[model samples]
Target chain A: MIFRSLLAALALMFVMSTATADQRWQRVEAVTQALDNRVPELEGLSLELPLVAEDGSSVSLSVSFTGSLEDGEHIEKIRLFAPGNPRPEVADITLGPLASPANIATRIRLSETQQVVALAITNQDRAFLTTRDVRVTVSGCLVGGGDASAMAMANPRLALAGSARPGQPVTVRSLINHPMETGLRPDGQADDSIEQQLVESLTATLNDEPVLTARFFTGTSANPYLQFQLTPEEEGELKLAWQDQKGEQMEASQAIKF
Target chain B: MGNLFSDHLSAVLWAGALLGVVYGMIAQWSRFCLLRGLFNRWQQNDSRRLRAFALAMAVALVSSQWLAWQAGINLTRTPYHPGNLPVVALIVGGLLFGYGMALANACGARSLVLLGTGNLRSLLVLLVLGIAAYMTMSGVLAEFRLWMEDLYRPTLPATDLTLVTAPLGLDTETGRLVLAGLLSLALTAWALSSRAFRTSPRDWLGGLLIGLLVAAGWWITGVLGADDFDPVRLASLTFVAPVGDSLQYLMLSTGTSLRFGVTVVAGIVAGSFLVALLTREFVWQSFTSPGHNGRAIVGGFLMGVGGIMSIGCTLGQGLSGFSTLAISSFLALAGIVAGSRLALRFSVGSSASH
Candidate 1:
């Protein structure tokens, strides 16, 4: 009886392993192919994510791109993808010349153990890619029955230092409102899956130059908040714009004086 | 100052008043006592009161799980489960806390209600517990606690009780809810069947009302306290931190937001006072001697230190922990009973010698 039970357990383990392996390999292939097709010139984008996340609902992510965004040679966009998720493509952000050269921080959710890919696209349409393996023990996004219509567009709020000198790194805090539906949650009242609706892009421009840009997905908080540092050359207006998957847009501008 | 009475403020005040009225009516009628569980067992050799407390735990466990099921609330994500077990600390902390509760004749929540009736002994105990809790929370004893936490860690890998049930091939959530419900039902049955317990409406009502209070705490923080800019931690009444938090609020009410625990603590005192006044139970009572006062103070200090280390006191761990049915609570509860019994034994031995 013991031997039979052991054999049955081993067989079950083998089946489970094979099933997971097949799904993961397929996802890996699809992700690689998508990266190859979409952002081919990927390089220099470094993703800093926690090695192990206890809760996947608010996993912190930081992306920093090295090298200057000089005239005609700048970062055009950054896209984040969670290959394991049903909607594998999480977010894509477009950057303008006035946006910061690099550095963005946001939270994302992971369904399970999966690779998070960050792809940076340069002005020349070259895509540079980097991937990190994140193990999400239990998905945190499984709250309140994943209903698509339950998501409400949140108003973004910004807070800046009251006073700061030129060339000093001023902290700019921004929070946006949105439910960031992951599309994998079973609908509360329906048998269908909740359609993904997450803020795809955020751009911060200081004096018509890109100061920072970020890509986000459903794993982000209900209302996502971001904090970043910008050494202002002079007191100027910081223009912020964010767009979600449904093409909803919100913009805010703040004037800073030293 | 303009923002003080704004819509948010009105909502908070109304919420507090509603909570206060409910708590006053229920707590006054029920006579909820966390210390009674251990004391009854030690002094009377009766498990009925303890069983009632356990029944409350069972009810809390089932109801909390039900709420979680309905709201999709995940207890595993909370700070209570840091994914690591500090076993030695929990056991030691539980024992110390139990002993203190016996010494003071009340736990933290009871102290608040007792204070409302002008029990000067409880007032000293509250002060000592609060000060000592703060000391341990961020002051001198914090380093020692952290060092001990690091030294005596258990290898269960994860501290969450739900994780243990997850591997049984049963639906993890369903398994947890069933386990919680069954435990609660068993305790409830045991408590209700006893002729003595059934006859005592005060005790049974107290258990039920306290269970509801624990549930109310979860709703306040999880739902009402939910904010995009600043989200409150999902918590219920746990006495150790809240006592310290209440003291801090008194000094820094301007800087901090109104938390549910603090509001609830305030409400309980006000409710109890009103009840006492109405019932003619509002008497200014103090210890006969400074020696008794000193004992109360020392008891409160031990409870503070122990509660902080254990992550809860009698009410905090007893009711709140029982509500969650988190494995750590079981261990802590056992330790508490053992500690109280030890204290009672020593006292009896000393009296016999005299």
Candidate 2:
């Protein structure tokens, strides 16, 4: 498995180096390659972020793809990258067959000013990408410690846009309590085992089938909040499952009617 | 979608600016100011303005606590609830702010209102104040400020009145209501005790409207701006950092995100300008002498630096921050009043105070 991963990384590097003259992509190629080996095309994709961020800890991010798809074709995955961070891979989200709108919004961390990139891929092997440059400033006035890490992955809250009609895509927002601890604290935080602990996995499912699956990393902000869209074929329940790197898990569900 | 603000933050800005317009108009008409209240009471033996200010505080405290209960907005998330109290910063910063108020005879919010009424000297004060705030916040003095803040993080179990009443066997919610009710009642009774203050609709109305405005600020930011996608900072009426933020916004509007505070700053100016013109009060005033101009500049700098340290200005700390009943805010207020009194004694003789 280690050898295979190494080969995959090298292949992605070769493809990226020959793909474009834009060195910006090349700089963060390793982090971006967590999605796939193929270079992404900047088409039918939009990534919105503030031009400047006062707090590098958590900056709001929104990415959406509204491209024309072939019959029966659907989006497969979407990934976010912040190369400036200690761990650049922010999150990887997979959309299942039932999902319609590929719009997703979440918060991310940037250690310094850098270009943040978002990539989306369709099941038909088409990849679209976009990037935004964010200038981060030192937050002089930051209060409180952080979210209650003790309750990490405990309660996952979900909000759905009501008045859903058949075949109409509905927006769903999910937020779960977790520190997303980077395990990068300095000496006196009392976190002796300064190892990377994170909410490694999350999934949204309808009828036990996946609607959206996301893999979170240290680059994701605390209390991971993800907003996405889903289209329901009928009245059913959508369940969200979350698990941290420690293998601890939590589940929550919201019923849909119409 | 949560709201239009969920997709875009412009709605939040507009709402904040509208509230600011109301604030500016009311402030202009009523001459509502804490420092003015202090100066007037000290020099002219007029406690009406001070009573109005106290009434505003009482109203803000009661209404804000009420909103938090009904709206389910967590007050703990706000900066007013610092995890580890910076006691030294509060006292020192408050003292400097009070002294600066005496030097300039106005705080940051008052300066903005005066500027709208065509006081060019206010323009100078605002520019310097904004620059000085930035200097202390993120410029040369930022590192020092952070260092001091880090060093002075005194671990306090309770930081606000709600927490103070927790030991009295009441739950958090009940404690909040009990303290807020009692304190607000005390302030209101004292404020209205003076027949002069009771009869003066201008002072009472100013206090009442501004108090309601603070609560409205919480509603806009807490409810309307409560988008999971792009959330606005949970805030109410304040003039300290926002004054500095407005200046920065002017220089980097395109490059930086538009915050609710900056728009409110703009709204206050535009609102005041409109009212001034309509009321035939639009007379441009500038520093009559170099000494006066120098005082304004120094006052601006002191306020900028001091406000940043204390985490608010007269309105920000004395009223808005105080409304939260944060213990540090209480200390800061004490420091400010003392600072202003000392400045009054040293800078101006009893005869000159008037």
DockQ (C-alpha based) per candidate is 0.05, 0.26
What's the CA error at residue B68 for candidate 2, in Å? 3.0
Docking class of 2: acceptable
| Model 1: CAPRI class | incorrect
Could you give candidate 2's per-residue lDDT for residues A129-158 as a string of tens digits? 787888876431232333332445655788
Q: What is the TM-score of chain B alone in each candidate?
A: 0.90, 0.96
- lDDT by residue (B103-146, candidate 2, tens digit) is 88788888899899999988988898888888877678776666
Per residue, candidate 1 scores C-alpha lDDT tens digits across A1-258 of 999999999999999997775344235664566456664433577898876654466677777787555576877667777776655655556666444455566677676667888777777766677778776533554343333333666677777745656766566778887777655541212224346677777888877777767677554666677766666778888888888887878988888788
Q: What share of the true interface contacts does each candidate keep?
A: 0.07, 0.37
| Model 2 score (lDDT) | 0.81
Q: For residues B123-145, what per-residue lDDT tens digits would candidate 1 score against the true structure?
A: 88888898888777656776666
